[model samples]
Target: VPDITNVQVQINTGAPGYSPLETEQRITFPVETAMAGLPGLQQTRSLSRSGLSQVTVIFKDGTDIFFARQLINERLQVAKEQLPDGVEAVMGPVSTGLGEIFLWTV
Candidate 1:
């Protein structure tokens, strides 16, 4: 595969209070920039009578390598700005790790 110029990603699913606007089983998180990278996604929280969530993203990946980089960047930026106040979001290519680990070995 060629070099992956970039990748686009977001927090899909489990976004608290994100259903009203993005009513869907899988909801992508907000992003700031295209090149910007986000951390791993965590569960949403209900704190202080407020609704918020976290979404992570990355760039390097096995898929989306080549071509669609520029376009993906645009989307990332938009997602970031569009995030709600209580919603903490990030941007980047989606991450896929088939690798398994943390097994108790005797």
Candidate 2:
């Protein structure tokens, strides 16, 4: 398989106790809106939970991962402005399916 060409955005609502609907409206939607129309973007998937929102940005095959991340980083700046105070949207680690070499069971 090819390297995983995707970027993930994690949003932590520092203060807890947020409902799913609130998280979706206040966090997920805005983030999704910010990511729309990104070049080389294939599609985006998101999940809004109690205190967190995860947005996975998938890019088309053959697209450079580094370039994709750079685009995401720039867009995140715009997203930050629309986010609530203390709520930060950060990128997840750089990992690929082939990076998994082994699995250990304890």
Candidate 3:
């Protein structure tokens, strides 16, 4: 199987007690907006929960994952300015669904 070209952006609102709506408004939207217009970007899906926001960026098939991540890394710098103090967005590990080579069951 071929590796999937995708990136996951995780936002951790350091402070707790944030409601889902607030997280969506403050974290998710800004991140999604920052990711807009990226080359080879297929779609972006986001999930906003209390104190956390997860955005998955799916690129077109055959897109270079490294280049995609670089684009995201640069954009995230700009998005940081819009985020609240202490809140930080970090990209998840670079792994695809079929990248795993080991499987174990206990």
Candidate 2: lDDT over CA atoms?
A: 0.76
For candidate 1, write residues 3-103 as lDDT tens digits.
Answer: 33334343432346544446221233233232344232122221121133333344444434233344445555566566545444333343433211223
Ranking by TM-score: 3, 2, 1
TM-score of 1: 0.29
lDDT of 3 by residue, 1-106 (tens): 5544354433334326778899899888999999999898888988888878888888887777788889989999999999989888888877765444434321
Model 3 alpha-carbon drift over 4 Å, by segment = 1-15, 99-106
| Cα TM-score per model | 0.29, 0.80, 0.81
Model 1 alpha-carbon drift over 4 Å, by segment: 1-63, 66-70, 92-95, 100-106
Best by lDDT: 3
Between candidates 2 and 3, the TM-score winner: 3
Better of 1 and 2 by TM-score: 2
Best model per TM-score: 3
User: Model 1 residue 92 lDDT?
Assistant: 35
Error of 1 at 79 (Å): 2.3
